[model samples]
Target chain A: MVFLSFINNLINGVSLGSVYAIIALGYTMVYGIAKMLNFAHGDIIMVGAYVCFFMVSSFGLNPVFGILSAILVCTVLGILIEQLAYKPLRQANSLAVLITAIGVSYFLQNAAQLMWTSNPRIFPAIFGNGGLQLAGGQLMVPYKTLVTIGVCVIIMVGLILFTGKTRTGKAMRACSEDKEAAQLMGINVNRTISITFAIGSALAAVAGVLLCASYPKLIPTTGSMPGIKAFTAAVFGGIGSIPGAFLGGILLGVIEIFSSAYLSTELANAIVFLVLIVVLLVKPTGLLGKRTSEKV
Target chain B: MLKVEGINVYYDKIHAIKDVSFQVKEGEIVALIGANGAGKTTTLHTVTGLIRPKSGAITYFPEREANLYDLTKMPPHKMVEMGLAHVPEGRRIFLQMTVLENLEMGAFCKGKATKEDLDRVFARFPRLQERKKQVAGTLSGGEQQMLAMGRALMSHPKLLMLDEPSMGLSPILVEQIFDIIVELHRSGTTILLVEQNAEMALQIADRAYVLESGRVVMEGVGSELAASEEIRKAYLGG
Candidate 1:
């Protein structure tokens, strides 16, 4: 019975980790290309969740359409934010850009509160309460858990291939290394950055939907804690690396789940943060980050 | 053919280029030799549209005729499209990418690099071909310089501008790089060479200009400047 419970917790941890992985992918990619920490990225998740919620519940659309619309809306919002908020400040210092990003984050959170109100809405279970029974009903894996894990895996593989093979992907990698050189090569730096924001925000939509589905709590602040945790996850794995974000997210989720289960429910977050601090102290660059040295 | 009619440029408050005027005619090797901080790189940058000039005009005649375009108004990438390739200072090839990838990026303006283009560059630098799969950062300094030149050649540029191509290389490697520059010039590419090594630059250049404190102090035929007593004292070492 103990073993079965452990297996259940492991699955739960992975499911939560999968959502964090998606969110971290958004953070890492934006940070890598734009060289800015976009604090407003979390609020994008809130907006996406609201869009998906209204589409399915109020508009009575199919769940697939709701998800698609959410992605589209978030993608457009991401591009707009980058152009209006980030582009003008491209030549500004890092501190200024960081402050602007924080301001944008607060604007999004307050806008969401005004639109959706503070009361938490129970998100509709689009996947329904279903599961696979194994070991003669001794263990069951929920469909939501299975789907979340599967989607995360697919997105990871797709991202790897896209970045590895495509022209635009190579251009993005080049821009990340040296924007001025990339521009000199006729790579259109601004367009590449806009495309990055679009991709990151689209992933944010998927993360938002999955997060609400698993937790079933739809609120303006629903994305905040998860967002911070995923950002931590990105740092844990190596902020600019895609694979790092995945590893960090999974480890963070597992740690959080295990700590809450075995230690204390109230201290799960604190434990997770403590583990992060220890890891950073040892590695400095996170698990998979490259140690970059300046060339003379 | 290119013409710069007294262009002035500033980097913030510092005047980097003061009424700098020089021209590269068809099939000519033009060298701009100057000491460090004398604005040789800035002159090349202004011509390539990487930096906007405070005043004056830069005109490019693709056909060497009445058709001329104002380079100051054009974007840097558009300058590449007009068959102008700049091998920037410090050999700024993408270090994380492989040699092949760096060359491919050089041909970015051309949509895709043809097999012929690859062969052409490979023929020029067989060393790059051998190490095409190697990450650029792992290559030796000399190899990186060769790769930078090979990358610029991939654009099939009409006019190739090289900035400090010999920086940080051994004397033997510098000779090899200069030899490659002369060879590239022989194959119908107008060249704009910027160097602090005045002796070697003057030897290969058809016409050369000397810059001091952002001003063109002297201009004459390569051999005459090389033979001049003042030139020998100021640039060629007394």
Candidate 2:
């Protein structure tokens, strides 16, 4: 019975971790190519979730269509935010850009609150009750968990292939390395950066739906916790690395779930942060980060 | 063919380049030799559309008698598309990318390079071909320099501007680099070479301009200036 419970918790931890991984992919990609912290990135999840909710509840659309609409909306929103707010400040000091990002984040949260109100809404169970049972019904995993994990895996694989094989992806990597050099090479750096934001926000849309589906509750501020955690995951896995984000998210999720299960439930959040601190103390660049030295 | 006429550039309150004018006829090697901060780099940057000069007009002639296009308003990418390539100082090859990827970036102006072009670049710099899969940053200085030049050539530029190609190279490597420059020039590419190594610059150049304190101090045939006593003392290091 104890062994069975451990497996159950493990499954739950993986599901939770996969969601964080999805969210962190957005954070890392934006940070990597754009070189901005993008506090507004987290709020994209909130915007996506709200969009999905409205489409399904008010318009009686299929959940799949609602999810697609959310992706498109968030993608456009991300590009608009970058073009309007970030592009003008590209040459400005880092501090100014950071503060602007924070401002954008708050603006998104407040806008959502104004539109949807502060009341929490329950997410409809799109997948019917009960999930696949394994080992003669000894272990029960929710269908949402399975779906979230499955989606996360597909996205992760697709992203790796996209970045590794595509021409635009190469241009993105070139831009991040040296914007001037990329420009000299005939790349439209501004266009590349805009595309990067679009991809990140689209990923965030998927994450938002899956995250709310698992929790089954939505509020204007519902994305705050997941957003922050995913950012943390990006840092833990090395800020700019794609695979690192994936690894960090899964690790953080598992650690958080296991801590909550076997240790003090009240200290789960504290434990997650504590692990981050320790890891950072040991490896200043994070696990997969390359040490870069400036040349004269 | 390219022409710069009375171009003045300022970095905020400081005038970095003043009334600089020069011209490069087709199939010629023109060297702009100067001390550091004397505006050789600034002049090159202006020509490549990386910097907009406050005064004077810069023009490009793709064919000897073709329409001359004003280049002052073009962006760097557009300048590259118009068949100009600048290999900036410091061997600014993408450090994290593989050598092949770096070369691929050079072809970005054309949208893509044919396999024959890639093979030609590889044939010119076999060292790069051998280490094509290796990360560019890990390569030695000479290898990195080769990658930078090979990348610039991938665009099949009609005119190539090289800024201080010998800046940090050793004596032996410097010889090899100059040989490559001569080879490239011989292959029908117009060259605008900028260098602080005035001796080497004059040896390979057909015509040269001497820039001092943001102004053109001397202009003559490369060998005439090289033999001049005053030029020898000021730049050729006796």
Choose the strongest candidate by lDDT: 1
Q: What is chain B's TM-score across the candidates, in the order shown?
A: 0.98, 0.98
Per-residue lDDT tens digits of candidate 2, residues A108-220?
A: 99998898898998876765568999889888888989999999989889888887777888899999889888988999889999999999999989998888888878988
Residue B165 displacement (Å), model 1: 0.2
Q: What ranges in model 2 sit over 4 Å off?
A: A293-296
**lDDT for position A208 in model 2:** 89
lDDT of 1 at A179: 87
| Poorest 10 consecutive residues by lDDT, candidate 1 chain A | A287-296
Identify the runs in model 1 with alpha carbons over 4 angstroms from their true place: A294-296, B64-66
Identify the candidate with maximal DockQ: 2
Query: Can you write out model 2's per-residue Cα lDDT over B1-238, one digit (the tens) per residue?
Result: 8999999999988998999999998899999998988999999989887788999999999885567789998877777778899999887899988998999999987776678889999999999989999989889888888999999999988999999999889999999999999999999999999999999999999999999999999999999999999899999788
Put down candidate 1 lDDT per residue, B176-225, tens digits, no spaces.
Answer: 99999999999999999999999999999999999999999999999999
